[model samples]
Target: MPQPPADAPALAADYFQGYSVVGLLAALGVLFVAVAFGAGRLLRPVAPTPEKLMTYECGVDPVGEGWAHTQVRYYVYAFLYVIFAVDSIFLFPWATVFAAPGYGATTLVEMFVFLGFLTVGLLYAYKKGVLEWT
Candidate 1:
């Protein structure tokens, strides 16, 4: 193995110093959370009541079963919403890149390809009646 230069020790020390700062910050964050939780526990009242002990759900008492069946259509709707939301996010970056010289045609074609995939998925969902409210 080749011997490192005299400056190598200084470089290594500086590299480790950066990591030491990060470690110190992480330690301080943990200590702060610990102190806050400890203070809350020591200062808070310990009175227990039936109302406080019972499980609460959206200001209403939990009914018969903890597990409730949800329709699969709700999940499908959420998935479709996420797909279009992400597509809209991609459009911002695509539009910026498309405005740059020499990238107009390339970006346009790529965006169309992306939109085509989204269109296909939407069409498939429509054909399956996933878009129907009935």
Candidate 2:
């Protein structure tokens, strides 16, 4: 059998061996970001005005109140897009596992049930006319 590790040197070697490169890389990343930010601060002009403080949109001057009304339909459409995107993320892994020998009928049924929920959601969105471009 091989000899057991020593108290100090072996432990230090084991610990540093795993983390020394990672620590060095982390330190280098911090140093790089710090240098870049410091350089920017040193080189940039220090001009502050009311126009700079105001929010700029498409080069248009400010009009009326800062707050504007937003359509709820747009939010619903975005939320549905997110739901489908998340659904696709899960489906890719499931499709990979599905081809494996051990998982057959059970995986098929589960996937269909998962798809059924998505189908219902899609139908609901269709009924609400959320998919319309006009």
Candidate 3:
């Protein structure tokens, strides 16, 4: 069997050289990040007073421990907002596809199915009194 051509070895060497270059750049990036973090640590002043350590709420002194009981209604409202927001997000893409040919009927049917699921979720929330504010 004939030995591989000289250009073949040259190409392999070039590939390995490219790998080393990438490795070197990655190492340099990590080194620079570490040096920056170390410089910030060394140059930055360390100042921690009681006032700074205390929890601040709208510039008012915290009266009690940080832990406090929160109403569950707020969470429910947030979840409902998220559900509707995502539904709206889906509408934009669906609108784009709805304008395209060959996707109208199928997309419309699928969208109704998706809306049905959303309606079911909303109905469940309503029956559970999650929609009520008081």
Candidate 4:
């Protein structure tokens, strides 16, 4: 049960000073950002034109209204892609772990169980005709 020396208080104070320094740096960063934005607002020219206000896409002049109906199939395809992509990512790590020494039979069974769930989901999507592209 040895007590800390008198210098312990100075060491603790220095530790807290590090946080104070970080806080000061963060405050200065915010101040600089605000000043930059304010200066740009005050010094920049304000000019509004029809072309500048129009929505531009791929360097082509937009011909139709900005608000337009989109096909739901594209969204469904993107969602299915995300789901399978994430599942494949998890499979890689699981495969690596399954190959390790202590994780032989138990890991194999568990992995099959996980794949069964993924298979069920894929089958459900297939049954609903979500996998078809037309």
Candidate 5:
């Protein structure tokens, strides 16, 4: 291996200078946020009325319970959507890589394995009647 130049210390300082600049900028950002929050807290009025303290929902008065039961089917649908969305994302990159030389057979097999897993999950969901709308 080639020996580093005699000016290695200078190079190290130059590298650290970049980090120091970044650190300074980060500190400035935090300081700015702190100053803004402090100014807002100091300048804002402290008067608290019943209406102001209560939760406001548009212009309409509050209705029944705030918490409502959400159906598990909605969550299942969302999970399936996310799975397919991620599958599409992976597909695009895999297509590009699959077209590259020498990666054809390997990527093809790997992709089949991936699709197999998805298919198994889909079949499992179907068996569980999760796909039923009723």
Candidate 6:
């Protein structure tokens, strides 16, 4: 395929022209949201009272302080699991790409680099004792 001119101005102009419809649609989406919000604010009834102002949870009246202490380990464990899960998901597509004729070497190197990053993250988590279960 023939390449376009590498000049910054020319490249930017071409890029904008190529994506003009996308930009226009994005702008329109933003405008639609703004108009919808503006209309909602103008039309909605505001009759604030004590009952309405109070925090409601699943039709049950909130009791005690809203703030509660949560264990940080639970979140760390969940985040670590999510990272591994997503990385495993990435491997399936890479496996297919690795089997393909022209992409094997490139894909293999890329996969190693990706695995190296995941190894570093896992090592960091292990060092922090996040992997240890109580």
Whose TM-score is greatest here? 1
Model 3 worst lDDT window (10 residues) = 59-68
lDDT of 5 by residue, 1-134 (tens): 99999999999999999999999999999999999999999999999999887778898777887788989999999999999999999999999999999999999999999999999999999999999998
lDDT of each model, Cα atoms only? 0.95, 0.90, 0.95, 0.91, 0.96, 0.93
Per-residue lDDT of candidate 4, residues 1-134 (tens digit): 99888799899999999999999999999999999999999999899999899888999999877888988888988998998899899888888998899998988898889889989998998999887888
TM-score of candidate 3 on Cα atoms, chains taken together: 0.69
Q: Tell me each candidate's TM-score.
A: 0.81, 0.68, 0.69, 0.66, 0.75, 0.69
Error of 5 at 69 (Å): 1.6
Q: Which stretches of candidate 3 lie over 4 Å from their true place?
A: 1-36
Clashing pairs in 1: none
Ranked candidates, highest TM-score first: 1, 5, 3, 6, 2, 4
Q: What TM-score does structure 2 among the candidates reach? A: 0.68
Residue pairs with clashing backbones, model 4: none
Per-residue lDDT, model 4, residue 65, is: 79
Clashing pairs in 2: none
Write candidate 1's Cα lDDT for 42-112 as tens digits: 99999999999988899998889888898999999999999899889999999899999999999999989
> What residue pairs clash in candidate 3, if any at all?
none
Mark the regions of model 2 whose C-alpha exceeds 4 Å error after superposition.
1-12, 116-134
Top-down lDDT ranking? 5, 1, 3, 6, 4, 2
Clashes of 1: 0
Stronger candidate by lDDT (2 vs 3): 3
Candidate 6: where are CA atoms >4 Å away? 1-16, 102-120, 123-127
The worst-scoring run of ten residues by lDDT in candidate 6 lies at: 2-11
Candidate 3 lDDT, tens digit per residue, 1-134?
99988799889989899899999999999999999999999999999999988888998999978899999899989989998998999999999999999999999999999999999999999999988877
Q: How many residue pairs clash (N, CA or C atoms closer than 3 angstroms) in each of the candidate models, in the order given?
A: 0, 0, 0, 0, 0, 0
In terms of TM-score, which candidate is stronger, 4 or 6? 6
